[model samples]
Target: MAITRRHLLQGGAVAAMAPALGLNTNVSAIGTAHAQSAPDGLKWRHGVSTFGDIKYPADFKRYDYVNPDAPKGGVVRMFELGTFDNFNLVVDGLKGSLADGVRLISETLTTRSLDEPSTAYGLLAEAAAYPDDFSYVIYRLRAAARWHDGKPVTSDDVIYSFEVMKKNSPMYSTYYQHIVKAEQVGDREIKFTFDGPGNRELPSIAGELPVLPKHWWEGNDPQGRKRDVTATTLEIPLGSGPYRVKEFVASRSVVLERVPDYWGKDVPVSVGKNNFEQIRYEFFRDDTVGREAFKGDQLDWFTERSGKQWSTAYDFPAVSDKRVIKEKFVNSSSGGMQGYAFNLRRPLFADVRLRRAFNFAYDWETSDRLLSNGEYHRDNSYFDGIAEFMATGLPEGAELKILESLRDKVPAELFTTPYKNPVGGNDDAARNNLREATRLLKEAGFETRDRKLVDAAGQPVSVEFLSQAQGDERSILFYKPYLERLGITVNIRTVDSVQYQNRLRSFDFDIVTTVWGQSLSPGNEQRDFFGSESADRPGSRNIPGIKNPAVDALIERIIFAKDRADLVASCKALDRVLLWNAYVVPQFAGGFQRAARWDRFSRPEPLPKYGVSGFPTLWWWDTAKAAKTGGRS
Candidate 1:
């Protein structure tokens, strides 16, 4: 059952036979399938498998779901955790979602652009006008905006949100840390002054800044609340969003019913949305039982990770009759990269050749076939999706334009450096790369003796791959074999979520197979992952403990970039630098997202892109249409 990246690549050759033997007729043929069954006692069962708490309505679709009827009645059961033991609020990574549920009830001055047109627009603030000078950011709050408690939202409240967040959540406070002052100019207008060009980026920053109520807690402390606040259920909390907490039952469920009189109900963003009258989130201790709940109609939607379950589970006769739908979206990895990362601070992994050696030794194609069921595409460059620098082969003019745009941020030498062209299969590239790695190891003062890579002291070079116990069995199996051929001994140990975080914080493991979410803006925020100063910090994501002057400098260039071209160039440069350093072994990117949902609901008009959450901002769920699906409760 154990597999490594090498095994997966090797298995790809065998997996190709599926079509030859008439095995894989379509997506449903080789993998387990899923579908909704007859409704049980629960109205809807929306289940999911996640390692962390289910903080909905924040970044997730909970904010997208709306009940048009505005019914005072039903509950929308959901699955997720309340808090992760190793939770962090740093701007770079996953912490933003933790505070999302609360954010759903609250309002921010601005909200980041999801699609294209309104990339950085105001939410609480009516308008954010930036003049050509871009000296100061003028924030205009909507006069109609008010807290759920009916208190008017004003400039003072906006100022207070900044003050409280800076003192309470420093990790998430990176946006406002540079603000000089926020002065109320008029009844509905406020101005935030920054040092220089920082003001030009105010729209981008202000859009993400969530507004807090100034009058709610005049004297209550922000930090003290974060440390002492542990509520298993709904404690009286007020928000300025569309929904308010109705009830909370610890370890059982939580319900949030829509506010009938939510302000700005007719706003462009609010139109034709909020289909669900009430949204409920429920918890389950096990994934199998969770899947069963969906089959029993305890949930409405579910996303499964196990290809085995997808290929096998849906055949239940109950599911067959219901006509539940199974769907897959491509290039939907959400910029997530899953690979083997080494702690560069360790001496054994200091050599770039060793890292490349590992890259050549392990095979991504094979890993996908065996573990992911051939549902993934191996990635070469770090840039995925719309990032412009991802082009592998370019002509002279295009190369010049790209180079000219990136010259200020990346090294000039990169113009001549060849792009890592797409790899087709187990070919000569691997052999040449292995030979190159061997040469680099020799040059770096290492040699293979007695079939083992050892330093001058003759100490064997070894690495321990730390992983979470839940679903890393396949990842461990995929990596072990390739490491063996490189004269490196691999040790994989699966630890619980909490234990894994604890060890990662201390840099106790040599290597870790982890997920790094590539953001729309990729820049210096990566400090948490590869920065020198963040190495020992418990919350910092920089597990590699890599400290390179070149990397640090490039990170600064990318973050402070003024335009998209510069940003892309910096990213390409950074990607090349990281690849040259061999800090991470590139793995699979652009994988499939498989989810099963009831076919009752229908999309209205324009469908949102793949990365968007299906919610109030995107579509309306029609109960009448859903009822016609012939499902028995």
Candidate 2:
């Protein structure tokens, strides 16, 4: 499935977004192997994992994190920041703003367990088989899976989805780049052949292929205009998931109704989820307006991103009287780097020393204290929340060995010194950090002339911080003075979301606040974040435009990791390299999911450790509570 605009609206962290659906289709067979039988050296299984650990067995019941018998009739009116002009998943991120929660209408071959670190169970696919080397993966589609139009999902739909998505979306293209071909070996089975072997993540990622309805995309609309999968359209596409588009208004709102006779409703993974009868997303220009809407009862749920607002904004009567709830959910996944990413495509940001100087000049301590009410922690590593994968102290053991192998290409300081951000809170500390930043800038061939920093050619050094959110503008304003003190002219350009995205896609900005969300088991996504190939790719997540061979090699190590330990060491090495190079000026992490919702919903106890408040998914309507709070049901 395409990267949803919701993720981008929430500060570009893809990790918190819902999983993309997967689909598979038929093609010419590579061999004579039957779908019932595994190929010579391959083994058929109900699910796939990053490592070899599979939590829920084949005959297991629904996921332990859900309420199996929970009531499910309610309307979830959520606020979506920014307008959406498109519902077409294929062209999302590249063409127009994607409608929020659009991914709910599609189902992948396999659905990842919210509780597991990196594991997926069959949803559309009944069973999957892969060889020891993982050169290819074969998925057997469930005959029971049916599109909303009462048509059975087939191998053709999956194949079409794979080819279309890989060709159109840069994110999907990079993600599925390894899968060289797709073939149908059985009536209901599809096979995905990878570029090579030894990449354990291929099988799992292949299962995440978003299936599309070929018949709908290839057919005509109500006015008889031919549907184009490559182009954006308002025509509602057919889906196989539990929810389908009920009604929508361009750039304003969209409502999805639960499929009454949903074919996959009885599936183990679907047992306790998709509780809302109608999921409505109302668009707003920004979160401030959205928060106001929530207060006025126009929105049912509100996810607070601003720490200051989270700390002080919800003193309204609803919260006071328990009609609304404010709670923090533990975030177990890695808090991947969210920072002011330097656009290396810009010649002005080419020097590592200058990037490091920018980091020194940032007074995160004071910023957190004043702007966020001291609610956030400064990000020290690319993988902050995850302890095992984070590079700390000095590299040793397996991580040392991995770094040693790339010593010639990486910064030598990484081996000798432990990476730490400059600390600043008091005036003296801030002054000291600014002095260090000035020294570093001077060393990078910049000179303070006429109270302005100038380069070798005497051109004044300046930077434009491009942002889409008011919160980001405020943060930039806070740091602008610090940069100005270093004799560097700072410009904060606050554009709308669309303009901001366009600037990011074209790498047209000097710096932008963005995020690279990380999964517990880091894999091919690393390539999109730091690999050389994605550095120049327009729509890729490599916002920093990193093109280091060392980073690329480390990404491969993480991808082809032989075991859990190997993966950890490889990730640590990559983290150390990124921190040492200073591709971004580290920002603050909330460390929790700050959310406020109407108190008419109830969730399963001890929610999945990794799910991070599975809102509206693991939750269901509570009639008694709804009646008390005057909530819709």
Candidate 3:
């Protein structure tokens, strides 16, 4: 799945707390449970969750994931996948890829802890509290919080940030849809009231909003021009984060420098993080060029996404001489689906049989072997893993109980058989699958005409597989023959990042290879992924343009889920429904961060459990290692 920071930023806003009611005990009674509860104030704890107790205590020192005294003096050069145009993340949204590490210029009220599943600690806000019903949440800003201009960060800034972003950014608007009002209630406190108290995730969602400096935009640039948050601009605005923009070459590179006297440097949450004194990001049009740059030492680090590349790409002199280090870091986190998504908006892919036929025509096993050296596994479920996100051995227990309500609406076959991808490791296996695909196409009002699949009106079935990466053409080419065998035309169109992103937002592609990042606890974001409302929204993650009532209902259940068991049941039911519909041709997925870097830095003893956020953020420059290898530091 496409695991962008945009996806990760949404993690903390949805509730992943302990269940007030026990598992299996709440599903039958959920129907009668009221959506809203009585109002009550909850004193601020160090962090928040759904069921389990907070990992950090009220007086905890710092997170265990980082080194409190890691020496930080190095220039860590990173690479961006595609080119970027706009530096504005809010207004540009889906139109531009935007500059990498842009979030360094802003701070959210609460930030996600890398090690935890669904928990957040205070950042700008020293304390955050909500009511039992979750009707409203209040945040008290830290007195020491100051903008780069040496001005105090205030409650007014918090309120203004919400109002502006909700109006300008479509993403923020959808994420903050449940929030009804934001106002300054006290000298340093801001209060946010919800549309109603019933939803359990409103408080956490409200905390995730990136607080913008009202004085910066509402006032003027150095030239005395009024600024608008919705307009894309190159002018660097004032920020209160740990770093500020040092220099930038439009669409090519952006460099950031640590603020030597930053106010929040010693804060508990900020300790041992943002260690690099100078961080740089250079842009490349594709991965091939980026890989070559890393090998030549033009770039400092590269993450190998292809299993085939990991197996064979690093046999260089630097690697053999031990000047470059290669390691596979374990990413023991929830995995989302990465597949060839069929656009439901297109009438050609609207039929379930037709979609299923497309899946049967392609051979994942052969593709996995040829393209990835058999290092990856064929992903079957939308939420694929050994975790709760995964659905194992069909629906049972609470999953069956939840799915029973939608028995009349979903596919009948789902009740009798577990979903599995069609097996095709060789020519004969592929032939059998295509024969079945041809039969299904015929049943779905399609027929072969001169060995080309034709519709009811005798028009040929053709689709363009839209992609941004130069590497994706190979994957598309791999499947093209299989599709051609079924009498369907496959057109591979590889565009630059900008045009590709615009195409995605406009719902212009027939088939696109996209990955949806799944969290251990699925919540509000599911609506943006599969809900009918988001199907038409421009920049929404609902890339397949799904508009099913069953999907919409299941997403609601997952969002307002009262307990862990209920969340699993809702997700499994949703996964089964999505799989039964055959929305996408499943692809391969791995649970590791395969990277190669010069041996000049060292990381904490153990990486974070939930993610591998990379070395630029937390790892420090190892002077001893640098001396041993004659590497840049």
Stretches > 4 Å off in candidate 3: 1-42
- By lDDT, who's the top model here? 2
Candidate 1 whole-model C-alpha lDDT, 0 to 1? 0.52
TM-score of 3: 0.93
> For candidate 3, lDDT tens digit of each residue in 321-387?
8989888876555567778999899899889999999999989889989999998888888877535
Q: Candidate 2 overall Cα lDDT vs. reference?
A: 0.82
lDDT of each: 0.52, 0.82, 0.77
RMSD of 2: 4.5
- Whose lDDT is higher: candidate 1's or candidate 2's? 2
Error of 3 at 501 (Å): 1.0
Candidates in descending lDDT order: 2, 3, 1
Q: What local lDDT score does residue 261 receive in model 2, on the 0 to 100 scale?
A: 98
Residue 572 accuracy (lDDT) in model 3: 88
Cα error of candidate 3 at position 358, Å: 1.0
Q: 1 or 3: which has the higher lDDT?
A: 3
